[model samples]
Target chain A: MGTRKIVIEPVTRVEGHGKVTILLDEAGQVSQARLHIVEFRGFERFIQGRPYWEIPVLVQRLCGICPVSHHLAAAKAMDGIVGVDRLTPTAEKMRRLMHYGQMFQSHALHFFHLVSPDLLFGFDADPLERNVIGVARKYPELAVQGVMMRKYGQEIIKATAGKKIHGTGAIPGGINKNLSIAERDGFLKEIDQMLAWCRTSLTIARDYTLEHLDELADFGSFDSNHVSLVRADGAMDLYHGNLRAIDKDGNRIFDQVDYQGYFKYIAEEVKPWSYMKFPFISSLGPETGWYRVGPLARINACDFIDTPEAEVARKDFLSVTDGQPNNITMAYHWARMVELLHAGEKIRELLHDPDLQGGDLVLKGERRGESVGLIEAPRGTLFHHYKVDENDQVTMANLIVSTTNNNTPMNRAVEGVARKYLSGAEITEGLLNRVEVAIRAYDPCLSCATHAMGRMPLVVELHDAAGRTLDRRVRD
Target chain B: MSDSVTITIDGRNIEARPGQTILEAADAAGIYIPRLCSHPDLKPIGSCRVCTVVVDGRPQAACVKPVMDGMVVQNSTPELLQHRRNIVDMMFVEGNHFCMFCEKSGNCELQAMAYRFGITAPQYPFQFPEKEVDASHPDILLDHNRCIMCARCVRASQELDGKNVFQSIGRGFARKIGVNGERALGDTDMAATDKAADICPVGCIVRKRVGFEKPIGQRLYDTRPIGSDIEEVRA
Candidate 1:
């Protein structure tokens, strides 16, 4: 056999555009596998010379799917610029409510809209039947639950952030509006129903993972480092916290490091093949330092979850791995559901807190010229670093979005799946789908990572050693 | 017949002072004629053309055209309303008015006018012109992106504050507001308390560090239309 190449362009069932290429040797053995991010958007440069105060609202253009994440993250960075080390209780709670709302809606959207079809219909199921419409046709109630749950979360965001699209809620040093009595009451009325649905979704994911454990154990699974933000006491704190990273066996690589100084601990490496930068722990170097982020990493890095029901659910999830980190790529769905439930619990707890109605919203102290804002976004960790001049104009900006943080891990997942599934010269729909399933586990938002826009169709091409096209399949 | 001049606007008779402009006469009658450049306190400039109304078979700017005795004017006819909507839409596309994140969003006259006209979006293609920001001032910001060249700040600086701090320089598409100083608002004698600082109808000249302080529903035009106050006077 001659050396051959298999290409899957613009993988489906994911947020943004990406492609995978697998190289096979003459012996027909897998030689190399890589995931390539093709688009480029210079957002950091685009925001240069803008006023510092506009950053929170301006960064929302980064991704419509997770605009709240960018809005809150940029606001946190601006808080540092305004010289406030802490926010008022009302401001903090309002922001927390907004963030939890974002997390809940985002996770629900990813699971129900993106992942459910693959789970409901097997990975090898007919391409025509493997989609959101198919899921809706077969599981109508689940589809409705997803839509209503997403709407509820969106309503919470609107109440806190003031609007749905480009919210101006989280301003520098504080929030613009505290929760009104009517808004709080409205959300309170629906809290129990939202919580019930969250529980149901959690059960679905957990049951599915447990049922398919044997098949999924080696299905693109790997052992690596995990990174996330945790509270001072090592509890999972999605909104605000210090950095924590643990090895594959759950040994602390670095714990409780301030994210403001994240550059000193983490650095990004550039590769010629992809537009996205590969970030890794500085001490371990690129090869060994690359780690995973998102729900799996967050679940692995934290010692405990704060909310009552989520903590109980976390205990149940941890038992499967004997209190160790769950490295299974497919386990991301179950972990995400755990977070979805936690976000719902957090929203309920925040609605009842009287501090959310407090009047004191903004405060300012000594000002700083440069600062960094880090948040555990729904997808993973997001970083926003900025340098503002004396005129209040931003002279510099650097953003490490969540999807970019998971770049290396996504590639690794693709390679693992390709090695296990790619057996012959012909490319089957099942083989192409397996690659997409692995990458979709991260829920990567490539549009945010690359900051680009355009529609892409899935194109799978098979080529010979001399670069001759053998066979090509396209799915629009 | 009387000492005061009488004019009929939209078929409603109204009394006006001898030297009062059409806009003033309409104001006295509690009839709202949409105007952007003509502020209550500032001298009428008639630059924005939003207040254009049919008078004696011809269109005239209500802010600058003096009302004539027994004159007939059409202020809110369907044709005039569409004309006003088109003018407002042009103002939107001529400049980059990011109402979503603008500090002057709800309070901005431009935005309020758009809402009153039911403009979901501008009909014309956006210019997306590159503009400059003069945030050099410690207490004020001069964002040219939102500047509609209303000259409210220029007139307020000269006539109200008795200071020649702001002036309109350049013409056509290259037009922009320039400070008396060489460059930057910080170099000018403009003070945060100057009338020019607060006279802007848009987000052009706004106080720093106070944006988004007023909650959404409490903003100036949050629950009411732009000319609701004048309309309420009739009620």
Candidate 2:
């Protein structure tokens, strides 16, 4: 059967500027599904040869949403070469606390603000209901829960880092602020309310899933290698750790890999079709090697969660599908809520640490050298690596962002899911939207993709070796 | 074989080694000090009064306070703490800081130090400074309301970029961190990878432009202390 071109430009709800295109054969099989991550932001190249201490500030600019994570990761990356001797214990706790706040707020933003519109209202709901305002109309309570959860997260950040966005204080040397007793008291008051809201929201999301159980599961089932943040002790850690990538066979393909290792295992091949590079893991070829991130990877990577509440929720999560690596991409929403629960409870634990009381804020004693920082961004694993020479100047920098982490697999998964669901030539909006939803589920930050802005109409027209336009579509 | 320096902190005869600032000496002497612009990672910009100490009958910022042989550094003095408290007062009023409505209330350095110094009310009339907030980027945020005018962010932009993407727009209290000609960050050539946002000590400068991506609990600073055992920098 000859192929029939089907187009869905301007991918919706995801961060940054991007578009996707899918091509189906006359047999109605998805012949080519491409996620054209069309943002060319060269943050790494621009950050070269600056003061090592300034990296946290500079790299944080790469993506505004996860700057707290990037800032910490940048600081840690510098610490990998330099040191954090200038920081005090209290400052450390404050930074961790602020990071948790970002995680909570960021995940909430992705789940509730960005993607929940699709989950709460059916994917094929009226376009008006496909937006956040629609969620407020259809389910006012859930919308409120989202606002409260996200607001509390931002509140925590403001309290610790002094700003809701691009906050400072958490760094290689130390943190800037100590949690005040009043701040502690306020957080305590807000925690329970937010947790209750999280529960209600998650339930609603679960209910939505239960309603579409068949569609959700059968919609997306592409498989690939997965990667994420792990503690040196191999624990589930979003901030401060080396990285690990596992193949679909449940075998460890790469362990404790440094940023340089990323260069070896992952390759970024630029296609003229889009500004973003198609990231592929070397062990797996472009087509077969699909990967995933966000809720799916977080649940898969950790042996267990740290919070008791989250642990219980995890079991409930597993029970929904017998818990053996549920690949339902729609589950990203429920998984996101589970992670939010863990964050809320985790905040309480961090707040109570006695050492969190007053201590030296800035060590001001010495500047550090080179280091690599890692954190699990809302999308996947985000890495910031910096090389600073003496004179406190940055000599080199490398950033493996969350979207980049999920690139190879994202492309494959899009095609796999699209093909499986689009087998019938009916071309319902539900089928097309689900394919895009799979990529958005990871919440990829394309602003940090390849660091460039190419001309409009970037399309990877798959031509057979003979150079025939087997498929042609634009990603603009 | 280091030069010995003597200074009196809160009536204690403390002998500080050479190259130790009065702030360092006072801190070594266990003085309760407050600060905003003096980061160990960067050069000292004694803008915040939290670390003000009395030395030789004049108040001095402890972070920038240099060590002198046979010098007297008075920390925790009623007069000095008052001055520090006074500075915090000005900061609280200069910005449109509504503690209850703010996201940084409990953890704000400005709030913590104010409470620490027992500064209850805004001694000075509120500036109620009103400026347009720049939310151009998705992850980072720029709130003009909470700025304390320390210029640390300016220093960061200038010192880091050497491109001078940021500068103080006006003189004195009216001075604000801004791009040249008052341009927004996104409007400039300054790369998003620039960490200029890291130098801000208050909620004024933020990364609000980034969008939804990171999961809820997996954030970097949420569960652990960033400065506890700075040795964890090894992590």
Candidate 3:
């Protein structure tokens, strides 16, 4: 018997970077698989010597694409560093509005623009029908709604923060933006419409995806720990709390711990083949230290969502698995929509609060010490730890980003997805592309996590049983 | 310190009292608008069109738009939005925004808005202007080529510390923010203190300090934006 060949070209529709390779056994049972991200940018080392307050400002520079998440997470960590735990009700409400705004734009983008292209347009659709343009052609309304949803969320971010992509909405200790009666009322009015639109669109999506379980079910499945932020009271927290982790059995491992406290349970180590460092719980730190974060992680850790609408969506989400293990690989879409609905309901609640109209914008202050901050970025738990000396000079800095939270688990999940999707196939481009897309389901933005660049190889080859090379090729 | 006042925007009488901008009122009101120059932390420069609104029938920067009673503000008027579109076009023309070639393409604000407003082609001829990028800073970069003159870099410099390192060199058709006194950014007394590079609406200003430290797909906002986590900071 001779060796078989496989090929996948210019993987379609998504952002940033990824690559995957699979090896076969003699009897065709999967022997091994490699997922390599062949580039690196050192952000952990870059944040040194800045003012403690600048963690949110500086680490935010990591990724322009998702600066808000970095900014917020960094702000949270900075607060931890400074040790300012209590927040005024008004301040808390305003900050909630800003965060919800971020969720709206980001979740909408992921569901409609990034992953929806595959599900809505059909993975096998013509290349023309498989992108943003394709969505515009087939479902102009959806495309338009997606754009509007994203735009509205971004607008909220800009209003509350400073700009759209990377705003300074969340500052250590408290928020910087305030609300007026007029501003609050307008957002409230918009929320009704926005929520209605979102519910309609996402419900349509959930239905569409449900109807086509073949693709969803067949794409991939993997088991891993779900790591996230938990409130001081131990409930799952999307923002404003401590780190939490749950294993495959839904067992809580780390709950409501401080940002710096993460060192006790978590560990980071570099692998030679990739720029991204693999991070996992020290408890799970042997060779089997597979852990996950982001959409999969959030869903895994939560018992119930805080908002009413999201809880309803959760029921639908849970029904799919019937309280069974949620494959880490498939949790991407469910996580996105659940957060979207939560964002809508939460923002609506914030906008309706009477205190949103109160006066108390900027808190006049001159800080004299260090601060740390933490928050759940779209991907997973994120931390910004800074140490400022007496002169307000930064002596040390550290940032643990969302992707970093999933670094170890991502490698494992990718292998699972790749093996399941590509192990048996003749290694067609479709299977390869799907494997890559599965990684993107997390929508990783390393830029905000640290700082990074893109480097990938497109190589495919066939070898005979005796090890004589049949063919090999590398792409530009 | 009871700092408070009553102000109205676009016929909506709201009390801003103190420490808030017209943009805050407008945003809370859920109005469709545009802006690029105004940021929450940075002073309002009114450089971009994304937050433009007509105050008392006079076109003004909504981000900095002050609220006054009986003030009739029109945010969605066709004229103002068209002007915003023109400003966006200037951003497109003034910079090398070939989204296909740039790493920041997919998540770029200018690119996203262009898509939102349906400005596919640069109505004006591409300037392809050759602007200098200062890579002196270890953690960031200033790519002049991608700057749309939103003046954000200028504000981050001026307001942040009264460091006027960036100034408009040319007038009208050739207006650009050059280094102060014809000096490179390194000689402008600019420390990492000047965060203008990160705030640039376009790709012109880049962070060289931590270049490509995090790979794509691992970024935070790429998944959930800052708005969703605003309360996290406050709480």
Give lDDT tens digits, candidate 2, residues B1-235: 5578777776778788888777666556555456777666567778766787778878788888788876776776677767777878878887877554333444456766666666778879987766655554434556677777777777777777566767777787667778753457556655556767666766676543111112223333334323223324324
Q: Where does model 3 sit among the CAPRI classes?
A: incorrect
A1-476, model 3: which lDDT tens digit per residue? 44443322222333344344455665554555555554466656644544344456556666655677777766665555446565556656776777778778877887788777777756556555677788888888888888988888887777676567655556656666566566566666677778887787668657865786676665555566777776666555676766777777777777766766677787877766556666778887846555777766776667677888888887677677787547646557766777788889888877777766565533324443555566776777776666765433456766667776665555565567666766656655456656656666777654443333333434555555676656664443
Clashing pairs in 1: none
Name the runs in model 3 displaced over 4 angstroms: A1-12, A24-30, A81-83, A361-371, A449-476, B1-235
Second chain TM-score, each model: 0.98, 0.79, 0.76
Better of 1 and 3 by DockQ: 1
Instruction: Kindly report the fnat of each predicted structure, to 2 decimals.
Output: 0.50, 0.00, 0.00
DockQ by candidate, in order: 0.61, 0.02, 0.03
The CA lDDT at B218 in model 2 is 31
lDDT of 3 at B189: 74
Interface RMSD of each: 1.4, 13.7, 12.0
Question: What tier of docking accuracy does candidate 2 attain?
Answer: incorrect
| Model 1 per-residue lDDT tens digits across residues A84-193 | 98999999999999999999899999999989989989999987888999988999999999999999989988998888767789899999999889999999999999
> Candidate 1, what DockQ?
0.61
DockQ of 2: 0.02
Best by DockQ: 1
Stretches of model 1 off by over 4 angstroms after superposition: A1-4, A25-29, A451-457, A468-476
